[model samples]
Target: MTSPQPLPAYSRDRLAERLAAGPVVCGEGYLFELERRGYLQAGAFVPEVVLEHPEEVAALHRQFVHAGSDVVEAFTYYAHREKLRVIGKDGILEPLNRQALEIARGVADTTGTLLAGNICNTGVYDPADPATHAAVREMFTEQVGWAAEAGADYVIGETFRYLGEARIALEVIRAAELPAVILLVAGHEPVTRDDVDITDACRELAALGADVVGLNCVRGPATMLPLLGPIAAAVDVPVAALPVPYRTTAEQPTFHALRDPGPTPLPEDLPFPTALDPFTCHRYEIADFTRRARAAGVRYFGLCCGAAPHHLRAMAETLGRTPPASRYSPDMSKHVYLGADTRLRAANQAYRTSL
Candidate 1:
């Protein structure tokens, strides 16, 4: 195959020109209110028929719009055809996706916020793994087609763990010819999954015609820095950084997933927790991620797993400090944790002399 073409030069106005003039932002990439609304079961997060609490969902959109998000995304990430088939509602994909978009559009109309149609990971990666991609592509094409037809300004293919899957979704978006952005999952280290470095994956997807290349999910803002550098430099398009509120260490696998039928405690639910708040955890991470990302020249910003309207509000506040149409300039290539300053100093001294 011939070498891929270079990514087109990005002009924010040219990109924004395709979209209606507005704040043009999303509150969060995904928000799960399953247990809170009594939809909890074995794994109620992926349920059939949307299980939408209409008033609550609408209110969330309004909250984000009021918080200054120009775009409000519908809660339709997992509403795929195959997912619905498990619960025996294969016919409702169009309606549910439409309803989800309508919910956001209703609030958008009232508050003048743009609505973004959201598509998410199929929960199963490695599409090349025999018969894996067939159904997912059909489901995504149907869902994305509906999203494009439902007056969505743009679509976000988010929280993707594999680049191959992202490219499939990107192709679907291209078929619809709707402007699109991709959010990949880059783990805390230089990890490779399915023989693809998460950072290289972002650049490849952009070459396939993704409008923006960035990251979402992964551990948290503190550890995602290693992956962001390559994506920011390799792709000429806008780079967005949205880290999830996950555990700092591998000690707790259940930190993100709920354990019991208990009140949804904020991140601070644990007594020993001193840093991240449960309810506003995404905001805390986003605050730091956006700060460093802005310094790294990332222009697009949003949240991913374990995010909410509050986090989006904080991101908007941070973005507003410097208006759009301005350029990004950041210093400090390296950052050391306050607790590790001593060791970092020693390491820096040794490396400096070697240089």
Candidate 2:
């Protein structure tokens, strides 16, 4: 009889600590050659490229590693079957997905770094919409499973819209016996279907199985900064985030308000305001994003969308010189303890003497 393979032992919090101990992981998303070569459509998620230009994938991974990313995520975020079908390479799903993980591992070995398994929502948001739930779960399970099999140190389910999808993905990671982090995508709205509020959502995911929870790839830093406090108040786990700011007036106020029973605004009718100009972003904006992120007690920070090497370099420099906060100080904890109901009750003994 063949011996059984030993299960892997890992959890989410341990992964969070590892990420926190080092410089922030920085990266951006772009299509691989397979997608660029007309094998895939323009808007759908791109597949992992194994048959072509594996060296290019490795090169991209090395760029982030050399650019000072403590963790370099693989480009397997869209390696799920549904996306492969869009790319006409449905038959190559397993091989391409596995190869993406291998490429990430190889780059990490050469660069002496950490590799985050890339898993993402199938770009579907609504759980109640029966039209897509099963498909979503199936894609998440397959991609996450492949990442685990390829020996990823950790898995990242990023840019997810709903908690249901996030929960389903995390369950798969647990079944695979792997450590996982979930990065939810928040809109202008706050509360989600679960009544877990953002911070509470983080706590709930942590309690369920997530090791770290935070936001990524929604609006720019200005908008994202405001939500951090509520999110912090709701969860005890470490937060990791990457805010993807828009490039120009063409992207602002991205969400639409309800039009009365009258004519709805077409895409052509909407106005795009440039909250920050130049399509990229200003130095102060980047610095401010870092400042707010730190204030929110975020343990990890990175960029998306318009972020480039200079922007990342600016963030690294800005954080290096910024003063650390005293929120975790002994005095603060003592004050909190003394303000608690137990402490208050203990201090009320003088009333007994009066009685």
Candidate 3:
């Protein structure tokens, strides 16, 4: 392999400066939503859409940024070389990442929002094999280099299931002299895919100089909330919680296990494709989680898969801030019509003739 390219000069202290000012509201989970809406192929999950359909990608970023996202993450979740290779598009990794960053940069520049260069699980890291380890490092180095070249404010290594793989990505991002956020995917057991304890993992990543370390993607807020206190106690850096918007129950801690194999449709009640509307938390619920997370010392907060613009809007409102696009005046009237009591009262009033 050729020598790793030199990264452009960028401020490594920007993320820390931004975080110190206030909480960060990020918008993630573009692949699942884009595919469900017919913008991209479902099974292939190719990220060339950034290059082929830049408008659509930029539009999504605009929605999040307008909805109060502090950071507009590049839609490069599965854009890694190895992931592209699975779909026979390995040769376009550079273009895919570069275009994705460019789109995100444009949105951020227009809205005055920060841009995060994203890198997720590469699906090629193996601690047991020396060759695989070298390949994994090189893959991350190349990706981070592209992001730095595109003027990303910081780099986030998220949704990594394996501690080793997450560490590798963190190392590469740090080597680029950019602030790094490392997010791990956890199950109900409070352990990673490799069975390492989450608290232990956070401590290790923090020790390795991760600017921010926390959990995301595998479980919903209800499931991930229980793990936050321990992680906060384990690490000194800010804790991040970007759970999926779905109601991930104990029976199905992770979203991937929610569906069976084959083309069979999930049960109508299942909140797979319709997560943004059905399974997502209301603004009040997001407010409640934010309150709890703040109490738990979690500084960075956002949504993972199944997130929509409204979710970010609610989060920002709950934090007592208005987004760039403020449509409604601050009022408690909407909350009055939102709970079970309102529905129960209406049902009770209408059922008098049933006797």
Candidate 4:
């Protein structure tokens, strides 16, 4: 095969241009997937894997791209100083964040996808504590600065449970003069943790210069969809919708609230975080969500937490895209037992009768 072509430097207009045109797909959930791969720990989710194993992180980025991601999001989700300090490794915080950006930068540059620097819920944002609020800004500022220096096309501030925290992130991104996609985590509450109505919070962020605003993470498609319509109607900026691939319901509005009713006991009382495998939505389910989200006026289509490449591929295809990974889409026609192909062995086909 011929070597790939080298393109000119990015103009950083990709996010705005793409959103103005149509939907753009961004894949998240590096921490969960990397933990499952045994390269990182789950509880802390510090993403030191990016520093320890940069190549694997790059490969994952490429997989997401192949599966139809329009952006290669740097895996700095929990690489903040606060998280590292909890693990007694705040010393390498900057290096870790920079490494994550570098790894994602390589994939985006090579594949011609938009590179996005990411900051998420700092977890220490206490509304009453003015000190914690300042700390969060310091964390976001440094991360966004590194992203801008790394030539990232834009920055994504996602999974903010407090509209207040999300607003701070938007302010930092705007101050950097880079486009901001601020996504809040609605969790199980109808409003943000600070009691701000979801629609109003999204509108407030949009008015504050957020290029895009919507809900992401915590809730699954089933729970997240109901909120998208209102928020889309409330905000004029491009709306973003990215839910986890879990079967969250009205009874259990968030994945953490899901209870496995099976006789077999889960490790914990609830089946969130590490034990949500059974609730994972199939690709077809994701496809359905994708179609609904597109129709709801969500221009930025993204997936978080429990997302895998196939889940992303399904969303992409539903958005009218035939990404490169579509080449390997499942074909029952090639199955020996389930398929009707004449080349299939008769013995294997006999199982059609439930043998």
Q: Output the number of the TM-score-best candidate.
A: 4
Cα-lDDT of candidate 4: 0.88
lDDT against true structure, model 1: 0.63
Superposition TM-score, candidate 1 onto the true structure: 0.74
- Model 2, 1-355: lDDT tens per residue? 4432323455544455665674355565434233444443345646544557687777766765555566677777677777778778789888887787888899888876667787786766476687677788778788887787777777888877678888878777777777777888766565555444666566667777576788877556766677776676676666777776543222342222212233655454432221122344675677677877888777677776445555555566556722122122124222433433345455444443354
Encode model 3's per-residue lDDT on 61-142: one tens digit a residue: 9888888888989888888888888888787888889889988999989888888998888777766777887888888899
**Model 1: residues with Cα > 4 Å off, grouped in runs:** 5-24, 33-42, 47-52, 188-192, 246-285, 321-355
lDDT of 3: 0.80
Candidate of highest lDDT = 4
Cα TM-score per model:
0.74, 0.73, 0.85, 0.94
C-alpha RMSD in Å of predicted model 2 compared with the true structure: 15.8
Q: After superposition, how far is residue 280 of candidate 3 from its true place, in Å?
A: 3.6
Q: Kindly report the root-mean-square deviation of model 3 from the true structure over all alpha carbons.
A: 6.0
What lDDT tens digits, residue by residue, belong to model 4 across residues 246-333? Answer: 9999999998898888788777686777889889999999999988887888899978988999999999999899999999999987
Pitting candidate 3 against candidate 4, the one with the higher lDDT is 4
Q: In the order shown, what is each candidate's alpha-carbon RMSD?
A: 11.3, 15.8, 6.0, 7.0
How far in Å is the alpha carbon of 80 misplaced in model 4? 0.9
The local lDDT score (0 to 100) that residue 142 gets in candidate 2 is: 84
Per-model lDDT: 0.63, 0.64, 0.80, 0.88
In angstroms, the error of model 2 at 7 is 15
